[model samples]
Structures are given as structure tokens and as C-alpha cells.
Target: MKSSGSSFYDRIYRLVGMIPPGRVATYGQIARLAGRCSPRNVGYAMSSVPPDSPVPWHRVINSRGRISVRSDGEPCDAQRQMLRSEGIEFGPGGTVDLSVFGWRGPAGEVSNDEQW
Candidate 1:
């Protein structure tokens, strides 16, 4: 039987996949939308994503609009670079201004022609 954890992660992945390239969603936002999970669960799901997955993992950040440090202690430069390539700018304080770049939700899904 399929584990419920897998199902929850799938829901989280689908939601994260919908986050466009330049915009970002907070872990809290994803959890709230995904339901039956917490921000920490969202973080866990992100960490478990395979390198080959299509989910845009870099587009999820903390509520403070900053990248959460990996448990493995790796630098977040890669995430920063990816976001930069997608036109996301960071302030001098090293946090994206949530007001400007925060994704509203999947309700405003990008058009089919728009490359995520």
C-alpha cells in the first residue's frame, strides 16, 4: 500500500511545482495550501526531492524570505544563483522582499505558454 507520507509529499511537490521561476512561496504558505502538514514538513519534502525532479525546490523559502540553511551545512549559493537567474533580487540584508516576489498561490497559475 502507498504510504500517506508519500501522498502528502506528492501534494507538496505538485504545489511547489506550480511556483513560477521568479516568484517564491514560503514554507508556511505551501503547508497551508497543501493542508495536513506543517512548514517543517514542507521543508522535509523539499529536502527529499531528487536531483532529477521537476519540482522547483529553490522557489521555496522561509517566511522571512530567506533561504533556510541545509541540514548538511552546505552553502545556499546554488539556490541564490538559481533565483538570480530567474530575476529574483535579494536586498542588502540577504532576504527577498516578500511583498514584491511572494507568490500569491496556484489560483494565479501561469499560462501554458509561460515557461516555469
Candidate 2:
């Protein structure tokens, strides 16, 4: 059988796959959807995703509505460009407008009033 870590990573991938173009989900949101993983675990799993993986890993952002930078310097900036290409607009602070673009996955819609 696969290790539990593998299982958790697979679940995170599946959840991340559901995020459509122009929309995003946060580290905490993906963690809750993946059952046993925490937000930090989600980040770890994401970091391990291969560059060529079919998963749209770029759609995952922080709860503050900003992209999580890679281990490299701030110049590893493709995530923001990808989101913008899909018409997801960022505001004055370089934060995506999560209320307008957050993808809540299949369970239901996340209310626009959510503090995030």
C-alpha cells in the first residue's frame, strides 16, 4: 500500500485540480478539503509537485490572497503572470481579489463575506 504521505499528497493534487482557470484556493482551504493535511502540509506537498505535473499548482495561494513564493528569490514569478493571463486581477497590494476569484471547490460556494 502507499504511504499515508503519498495518500495525502494525492488528495491535495485532486483538490488543486478542481480549481479552474482564473480562480484560486488558499493553503488552508486546500488542507481542509484534503482531510488529514494541515496548511503547512499542503505547502509541502505543493513544493514537491513536479514542474510538469498536470496539477495547476499555481492556482493555490495564501490566505492573504498572495502567491506563495518558491524557494528561489522573488524572481520566480510565473504564478502571478499565469493568474493574470486568465483575467484574475490583482489590486494595489499585489493581492488577488479572493472574494471575486476564489474557487471554493465542488462542496459549495464560499461566501463573499469571508474575511479572507
Candidate 3:
């Protein structure tokens, strides 16, 4: 049987992969879409992603729209650079305006009442 952790991570990867280039999603947003998982869990899965994985792990940020600081002292400069290369402009305060660049998940996946 597949481990629940692996299955959960797979689901997170699939969801993250759907975030189109130039758009971003918050960890909380993904957690809501991926029911039964917490935002922290999503972060954990993201941190565990393989260096060569195609999952757009750089597109996810905190609810405040900032790249989360890595606890390992690994700078988030690379993540910021990747997002910038994708045409995602960050504000002076370093937060992406969700209203302008957030992906609302797959069509019909989110409704007015469920908007993040």
C-alpha cells in the first residue's frame, strides 16, 4: 500500500504543477483546495520536492504573498528570482498582489463563497 505521506505529497505536487507560469498561489490557498491537508503540510511537501522536479514549487508563497524564509538558512533569493523571471512583479513590500496574479485553481474548482 502506498504511504499516506507519499500520496499526500503527490496530491500537493499535482496541484502545484497546475499553477501556470506568471501566476502564484498561497500555501493556504493550496491547503484549502487540498482538503485534509494543512498549509504547513503543503510547505513541508514543497520543501521535500526534488531539485529537478517540474512542479512549480517556486510559485507558492505565504498568505502574506511573500516567499517563506527557509529554516535551513538557504536563501529564498532563487525562489524570488524564478518568480521574477516568470513576469511576476513583487510590490515594494515584497508581496505579490493576489488580486492581480493569483491563480484561482482549475476552472470551476473555486466558487465565490470558497475564494481564498
Candidate 4:
């Protein structure tokens, strides 16, 4: 089935929520999972997360294991703090260790049927 209209963002947010805490996933990975081509779209989806969302938006990062942040705001620091509280380690070079904390989501199933 082809997803379109307003549901696309909702679908992306649901996928983002599926990402467990204390682990991270790249934008490309999320895009692929969402059956989308552009990782930037995944980033865009994340950036549009609603104020009342329960999704773990902080768990998504760039392919290079760096947080994708807005150039001018406190949101960047908030993301870093949230990740740190989750015990996700960051290097002195300002990179997340995806090898250690990368999340592949659920192992055996691929469905929107699961809880968000």
C-alpha cells in the first residue's frame, strides 16, 4: 500500500517511537524502514515531532552517529541531555558510538501492528 497525505508523518513518528530507549538508529535506517528513499525526510519527520509526542525522538540520529540539530536553539542541548540521561555515551569528538548503542528496532517483526 502507498502511504500519502497527513498519515505519512504519523507513520514516521510511530516508527520513531518504536525505537527503544538507550539505543539509537540512523536516519537512513529509519527511512528504509518507513519505505522512504531520503534520510532527510526522516530527519524532517523527526523535526516535526509534536510538543505532546511520546515518541523517543532523541533516539534518532544521523548516519555518521551525530545528532542532527537546528543551528540556533536549545533543542540540540536538550537532545544531548536526554541521550546522556539514557546512558548513551558520546565521544570527546562529539560522536555517538553507534557500534555500542545503535538500535535495529525489533529483531523478528516488521509491522505497524505493534505498540508505538
Best of the candidates, TM-score: 1
**Candidate 2: where are CA atoms >4 Å away?**
1-5, 108-116
RMSD of 4: 3.8
The reply for model 3, stretches above 4 Å from the true place, is: 1-5, 73-75, 108-116
Over 51-111, each residue of candidate 2 has an lDDT whose tens digit, in order, gives 7767998899999998888777462377888899998998986898889999867555444
Model 4 clash number: 0
Model 3 C-alpha lDDT versus the unseen true structure = 0.83
How do all the candidates rank in terms of lDDT, highest first? 1, 3, 2, 4
User: Can you tell me which runs of candidate 4 are displaced by over 4 Å?
Assistant: 1-5, 71-75, 108-116
Q: Deviation in angstroms for 90 in model 4?
A: 0.4
TM-score for each of the candidates: 0.85, 0.82, 0.81, 0.81
Task: State how far residue 13 of model 3 sits from its true place (Å).
Answer: 0.2
Candidate 3, run of 10 with poorest lDDT: 107-116
Output the worst ten-in-a-row residue range by lDDT, candidate 4: 107-116
- The candidate, 1 or 2, that scores higher on lDDT is 1
Residue 42 of model 4: what lDDT? 85
Can you write out model 3's per-residue Cα lDDT over 1-116, one digit (the tens) per residue?
44536677777887888788899999988888788558999999898999887898989998888888888765589888999999999999788988888887766343456332
